[model samples]
Target: MKYVIILGDGMADEPIEELGGKTPLEYARTPVMDDLAGRSEVGLACTIPQGMKPGSDTANLAVLGCNPRQYYTGRSPLEALSIGVDMKEGDIAIRTNLVTLSEEEEAYEDKRILDHSSDEISTEDAAVLLEAVRKELEEDAYHFYVGTSYRHLLIWSKGSVTELTPPHDVLGQRAGDHLPAEEKLRAMQKKSYEILSKHPINLERKAKGLNPANSCWFWGAGTRPSLPSFEGKYHKKGAMISAVDLLKGIAVGTGMANIHVEGANGGLHTNYEGKAQAAADALLKDGFDFVYVHVEAPDEMGHQGSVEKKVQAIEYLDERVICPIREALDKAKEPYRLLVLPDHPTPIRVRTHTSDPIPYLLYDSEKELRRIGAYNEREARISGILVEQGYELIRKLFEN
Candidate 1:
C-alpha cells in the first residue's frame, strides 16, 4: 500500500496557564484528527533522537531514517537545491530567515520584537530582497544567493566548513540566546542583518502600512546536503510540501521533485488552502507513491501563543486539506495509507522547537478505525502506536 504522510511542524506543546495549563493541541478542536485517533491505533513517535536537538531539518532526516549529525547539510542548502540552485564541492549554503525585528514590541528580544516573525514576506518580494542582499555582498568574497521566502544561500569559498553554525532557527536558538557567530562570522551576520533591515522592499512595505519584515536572521548555516534519493533507496517516487528550504532541499537533493505552491505561507499567518491543495494534487498524480505534506502554520501559531489561530489552522487542515484528500482516496479506492504526526513541539512557553515526544497515528484499511480523541500531546500517548523515532514511524506505515 502507498503512504500519505502529513507532518504538522511544531504541533506539540507544553502546558500553558492561559488554557488552564493545557497545550494548544489539547485545547484545539481537531475533531477529524480525533476521530481518526479513535478509529485507529494511536501512539507517540519521536522524529528525532532523545536529548538531541530537534528541528525540521534534522528531524526530517530522522523521519527519512537518516541521522542529522551525519546527514544534515543545512536548511538553506535544502531550499537552494529545491529551487534548482546547483551546489558543487566546497560550497556552503545557508537558509536565512528574512524576519522583522522591532525592539518595542515583546518581552523576548529575539523571540518577539516589533515583528520577529516570518511568512508575511511574499515570494515575489522575497526575490527582490534576495537581489538586494546579493548586491551588497560584492566584496565579502563569499557568494550569496537568495531563494524563496526569507531564505537566502551563502557560499564560503575560503572558510573552513567547521567555522559556522546553521543560521538562526529552532536549532540556532538552542546554541545560545543570540550571539552572532563566534568572531569572523559575527561581523558578517550583523552586516547581513543591517542590509536586509534597510532594504528598499522593507521601506516599501512600511510605506504601505504592512508589517515590514526588515532584517535577515541567518542561522542553520550548513554546507550542501548529500543524501540518497527515494528512487535510489526505496525504489519509490516521493514529494513533499514544506515551506522550509531545508525540507524542500532534502526532497530535491534526494532526487524528488519539489512541489512549489502559489501563495503557500510559512509563519504565524499563512494560507491554509495553498498547502493542502498542493499536497492533494501531488497525490492525485499517478507516479507518486509517497507524499509528505508538512504544515508550518500550525506550529507558528502555537509558538505565537495564538490559541485561536492554531486551532483555526488545525481545523482548516482537517476540513479543507485532510478531509478532501481522504474523500478522494475513498472514492478512487486508492490502496493508500495515511500517517499523521508532528516533528516536535514548539510550545507556547518555549516558542521554539523542543525534544518532547510528539503524537502519531497511522490509518489503513486493515486496522480497526478509532474515533478521534481530544486535541493534545497526552491524548496520543495512550491512543496511537507510540513509535520512538521517524524511521520507526516510516516502518510502521510500510509494514504489511
Candidate 2:
C-alpha cells in the first residue's frame, strides 16, 4: 500500500455569516472530497497538541513523526537547508523577508510586504544584494545571505550573543519587542541597519524604483538540527510536495526527495491546479509510496479574509487536483490510498496560521464508507478514523 497526503496549508476556518453561519470548509461545495469521504473511512485528526497554538514548523514536524522541541532548528534555517545552504553550530539563521522600509517612518519588519513582486523573487536581484550584504555588513560574528524574497539566512559566530526574532513571522502584523537573543544579534541587526540604510544597494533599488529591502529583520535563530528520516520509520520511499522552502527543507533533511517543478509558487497568488498536478505526476512517476502535497494559496486567502477566494480554492482542489488524483488512483493497476486534510487553520478572523486541528477524509477500497461527515473540525470528530495526530495516520497508511 502507498500513502498520498494532501495538505492544504492553513486549511481551517471560523464562522462565516455569509455561508449562513457555516465555516468556509462547511460551506464550500467540495463534492469530490465529500464523495471520497463517503466511499472511505472518514476521520477528523488532531495535527498538534491542544491549546499549544503551534506553528507550521511544529505541526509539520509532528506529521512527519518528529518532535518539534527535540528537532526544530528554525524555519529559515530549514529553508536554507532546502536551498542547499549548510549551517554550522553558533550560526544564527534567520528567514529574512524582502521588504520596503520607509525613510520617514520608523521601520519594522511587519511594515514591509512579505512577498514582493507577487511571489517571484528574482535570483539575479537576490544574488546581487546577497553579495553586497556579505561584502559590507560584517560584524565580528555575523554573516548573511538572501533566501527567497523578503527572506534571508543569517549566521552568527559561536560564542557571539545576539538577541532578536527572525523576521519571517512578523509579516503585516505587530511583532512585540522581545529581548534580543544576545548582544551579538542585537548588534548585527543594528549594523545591518547602519550599512543597509541608504546604502548603494537600496539607492540602486530606489533609482530603479524597485522595492528596497533596506534593513535586515532577523528571527528564528538556531544551529543545525538533527532529525531522523521518515523513511526509516515507514521503510518506504517518500517525497514532500510543497512550494515552501521550509517544507522542502524538512524533506531534504529527512532523506526524502524534493521534486521541484516549474510554475510552482508558494505565495497566495500562484496557480493552485498547476502545482497540484505537478506534485501528483511527480509522485506517480517516481513510484513514491508517500507523497506529501501542501497548498499555500487557501491559507493566504483565509489570512486576507477573502472568503470567496478561499471557497474557490477549495473547489479548485476538488475539481482539478483532488478529483483527478482519485481518478488516477482508480486507473492505477495496483491499489492506492489518498489522505486529504490541512496542517492547521489560518482562519479569516486571525489572518495567520492557527493551531486548530483540521478535518480529513481517507480514501481506499478496503475501508468502508460512512454517513458521518462534515468538512469542519467539529464535524470531523464524528467522521471516520479521527486519529489523535497525523503521525499515526501516516503510519497507518504505510502499515498496509
Compare the candidates by lDDT and give the number of the best one: 1
Q: Give the 10-residue window scoring lowest on summed lDDT in candidate 1.
A: 166-175
List where candidate 2 sits over 4 angstroms from the true fold: 50-53, 100-103, 106-132, 159-184, 187-215, 269-274, 384-386
| Model 1 alpha-carbon drift over 4 Å, by segment | 103-119, 162-177, 182-184, 193-198, 207-209, 267-271, 274-278, 370-375, 383-385
Per-residue lDDT of model 1, residues 154-177, tens digit only: 666545454343332443242235
Q: What is the lDDT of residue 322 in candidate 1?
A: 71
- lDDT for each of the candidates? 0.67, 0.66
- Candidate 2's TM-score: 0.83
C-alpha TM-scores of all predictions: 0.86, 0.83
- Winning candidate number (TM-score): 1
lDDT of 2 by residue, 1-400 (tens): 6678887777778778888888877788888887777676666667776654456777787777776656776666677788887777666566554444444465442234342222334555666666666787666666676565555677666744334443333444443253255655555554555566566666777677666665555556556777787788678788887777788888988998887756556655555666666656766776787888777667767755679889877777777677777677666654777878887787877567766667777777566566656555556766445677555666655565
- In angstroms, the error of model 1 at 291 is 1.0
